[model samples]
Target: MRMSEKRAKMVMSQFKFLFFVLNTTGLYVSHESRDASLGFMVQRIRQMKFVGSVALLAFGHRLTASGFTTSPHLSPCSQIQRQFGHSITNPTRFEASVTQRSLSTKPLEFPENPSPFSTIKNGILTLHHRLRNEEVLQWRALAFSFFSSLFLFRHAIDVKLASLWTFLTTSSSLIPRIFRTDSYEWVLAVSAFFFYIHFFWYADVSVRKASEQGKVHPWRKYRLQDRFEADKHRRSVELKLRRNGEIPSQNELVKNYSEVTKQTGWNWKAWTCEVWVYVVPLLTWDILSPRRHRRLAAFGAPTTIQVLRDITCGLLLYDILFFTGHILMHKIPLIYRTIHAKHHQEPEVRAGDVVRLSMVEEVLEVGFSIIALNLLGAHPISRSIYNLIITFLLTELHCGFDFPWTPQNVVPFGLATGSRRHHFHHRNGKHYYQKFFFHVDRLFGFFQKDDGSLHGDSVKPNPHIPPAWQ
Candidate 1:
C-alpha cells in the first residue's frame, strides 16, 4: 500500500513538472523579433512540450499499471485511476499529430501599412543598425580623438602655454625675432616682404569668418547667395563695392572687430586654423628662402626681370613636385586614408581650409615648396614674391568666392586652374591635382576644362540638387 501511494505521489509530481515546462514553452513563444522568428520560436516550444508530455505519460502509465495489477476486480479507485492514466498516456500516441498541426499553422505577417509611430521606430532602428557598422564605428573613433584633442588643447595650451606666451610677449617680442638671425638686414627684408602675405592671410581669414556669420559692414563681403546671375554678377557686385569704396570709420572698425571676436575667439582654433597654416610654410621658408646667401637677399633688391624669372622657374619646379605628390597621395590608398583624408574632410572650402592638412602632408608640402625655391637659388625678394603669389593663390582658391576678375579666371581658359575648378576638385578629389597650372593636369587627364559653356554664380549648396562635380 505504501509502495502504491509513493508511486501515485511520484506521478503527481511528474504532472506538476510537465505543467511548469509547458508554461515556460508558451512564455518563450510569446517573444519574437527579426532575430527571433515566430516560426522558429513556435517550433522550439512545441519540441519542449512534446518532451514534457512524453515524460508525464511514462510516469502516469507505470502508476496506473501497478494499480490495475494489484486489484482482482474493478474498484472505484482503480476505475478512476485507469481513466486518469488513459488521458495522461493517450497524448504520447497522438502527440505527433498535434505537433504536425501546430507546425502547419502559418507564421504571422507584419501589417501592410505600419503606423506612423512604428515607421519612426523602424527608422530609428535602421539608424542604430547603421551606427553599428564598421565605417560608422571608425567615424566615432575619429570623433572621439578630435574631441579629446580639443579638450587637451583647451586645457593644456590655454592654461600652460598661454601664460608662457603672454610673459614672452610682454617682455620683448622683437627681441626674439632679432635673436633668430644674426643680421638685421635679414630681419628687415623678411619682415618687409612677408608682411604682405601675413596681412593678407589674417585679413582674409577674419573677413571670411565674419561673412559666414552674416556680419554686415562697409567692405565687400564674400557672402553665399541662393540666387545669382552669371559670373558677371560677382564682378558687378565687386565693381559696385569698389566704385562706392565705403570705408568704415574708427568706431565701425572697433565694432567690426568686436563682432569678429565674438564669432571667433583667439583660442586653440585661431592657432590651429589661422596661425599654424601659414606659420609652417614660413618656418620652412626661413631655411630655404634664399639658399645662396647673396647680397640681394641682404642689402640689394632684385630687379623685375629677376623676380619674374625666379617666379616662373620656382613655379614650374614646385608645380611638378606638388602635382606628382598629390597624384601619388591619391593613388596610394594607405597614404590617402591615413593622411590626405584629413584635408579632404572639409570639402566646402574656407580661407583656413587652404592648408587644412595632416601634419605629415603639411610638412611634406612645405618641404616641396622650400626645396624648389632653394634649388632655383632664389633671392629673398623673388623668394618672397613667389611665396606671396602661392599663398594668395591658395588662400583665394579656398576663399569660396568666385569673381569674373579672380586671378584664375583673369589668367585665361587653358592656363591656370581657377577658383571654380579648385573648389570642384575639393568637392571631388579625383580630378585637378595641379594647384596653379593646367598643363600637367591636362596631360594626366585629371583636368576639368572651363569651356565657358557652364556658368552659375550661386555659391550656396542646394540639398536636393546633386553636385555637378560629383
Candidate 2:
C-alpha cells in the first residue's frame, strides 16, 4: 500500500474515534440540556459545523503533504474546501483562508424578546449581584449577626433534643435493666461530649469577637494583670542582656514552661491508646456495678430553683476539688510531669485544646465533678446543665480571648476565670494554680499580681525548678 493511503487510513481512524467519544458521552445531549433557548441551540449548531469544516480541511492537507494525488471522484468535504479556495498545495494560503472565513462569520443574533427561561435566569443573576453588593456595603454585619444567631439557635435546639433523649432513655423500660444501665450512662456521656464539641465552635466565634474589640473589658481586666506584668519584666530583662553585649539563652528566654518540652508533632497513637484505656475501664465499671449505676441513673424533672441550686453547688464543689488537684499537680512535681502536664503541652492554647489532657488527669478532673454532683442529689437535668456550663467555661478559658461581651464580663462577677488568667498559669506553672476561683490562689500566696506582688506583698524571685520532683 502507498504511504499516502496509510496516512489517510490513520486520519480516518482518528476521526472515527473522536466521533465515537462525542456520541457515547452524550456531549450534544448535555449541551442541549444546558439551554432550552432556540437561539442558543442554533448558535451551538453553527459552532459544531465550523469545527467540522476545520477538521476536514486539515485532514485533506495531511493527505496532500503525503503526496496523495487528488482523484476526480473527490470526497464532498474536499470539494467544498476547493470551492472555498482552501487548497492543500499551499499550506500558508490554506491557513489564511481558514482564518479569514472564521473571522468573517458573524455570531448569530437573537430576537429583541428573550425566552421566558432566559429572562428568569438573568433576573435571578441580577438579584444575586445586588444582594452581594448590599452585603459588602453593610460590612457583612447583618450576615454575621444572622449566622451567629442561627448557630446559637441550633445549639439551643440540640440541647433540647439531648435532654429529651436522656429523659426517654432513663425513664423507659423498653430495654432490660442489664442493658438500661449502659444505655443511660452512654446517652449522657455522648450528650456531654457533643456539647463539648459544640462549645469549641462557640469559643472560636468568641475569640474572633475579642480580636475585633482589641482589648479585654475592665471588669475582667484584673485577671490578666499578672500576665502583662510578667511579659513586661521578661522584655526588660532581655533588653538588659542585649545592652550587656550578651544574647539571652533559650532557657532564659522561655516564658511558658510548656514551650520548653512541648511536642513538635501530633501523636495519633497516644491519643487512640489513651481513649481506649480511659473509656474501657469506665464502661466496665458502669456495667458491673448495677446498684450504684442504677442509683446514679435515676432521672427526675427538677424545678427551676432546684436546678439553679444544683448548678451553684456543682460549681463550688468542682472549684474546690480542681483547686486542690491543680495545686498538688504543681507542688508534687511527679503528678505535674506525668499526668497534669499533658494539658499544659500547648502554651498558646485554643478552644479545642480543652480535651487535650492525660487520660488519668481527665478522669480526675471531670469524673470527680460528675460524681460529686451526683452524690449531692442533683437531678439528671441539673447535672447535664452543669456539664454543659463546665464544658463552656473550660473551652472559653483556653480560647485565648477576653471579649467584653463574654458572659464573664456581662454577668457581674461571673465564675469564669478569663482566658488570659489561665494562659498565664500555662506560661509560669509556679503561680496561679487555681482555675475558677482567683481568691484561692491569693489565699495560698500563689497569686502573683501584675506589679510582681505575691499575696499583696513584694516577693523575692526564685530560681527555675525542674518539672520532676526530687
Q: Pick the candidate with the highest lDDT.
A: 2
Q: After superposition, how far is residue 210 of candidate 1 from its true place, in Å?
A: 11
lDDT of 2 by residue, 235-349 (tens): 6667889999999986675444211111123333333555466567777776676554455456543455566688878887888888888878888888889988888886655
Per candidate, the number of residue pairs that clash is 0, 0
> lDDT for model 1, on a 0 to 1 scale?
0.54
**After superposition, candidate 2 runs with Cα above 4 Å error:** 1-273, 290-293, 296-300, 405-407, 413-415, 452-470
State the lDDT at 8 in candidate 1: 67
Q: What's the C-alpha lDDT at position 312 in model 1?
A: 85
What are the per-residue Cα lDDT tens digits for candidate 1 across 1-470? 32466566666666666655654555434432234345555455545655665665565455555553344676424443464544344533233433444543432432234658999999989877876764434465555676567555554544544464344334557763443343433334334434533544465455546546765322223322111222333344445656788643433322221223122121235344635564656556666664333433343434445556788899889988998888889999999999789777765555556556777887787688878987987765566567667766766666555543455544534477756567767766778788878888888778544443223223222211112111
lDDT of 2 at 438: 60
lDDT of each: 0.54, 0.55
In Å, residue 85's CA in model 1 sits off its true spot by: 99
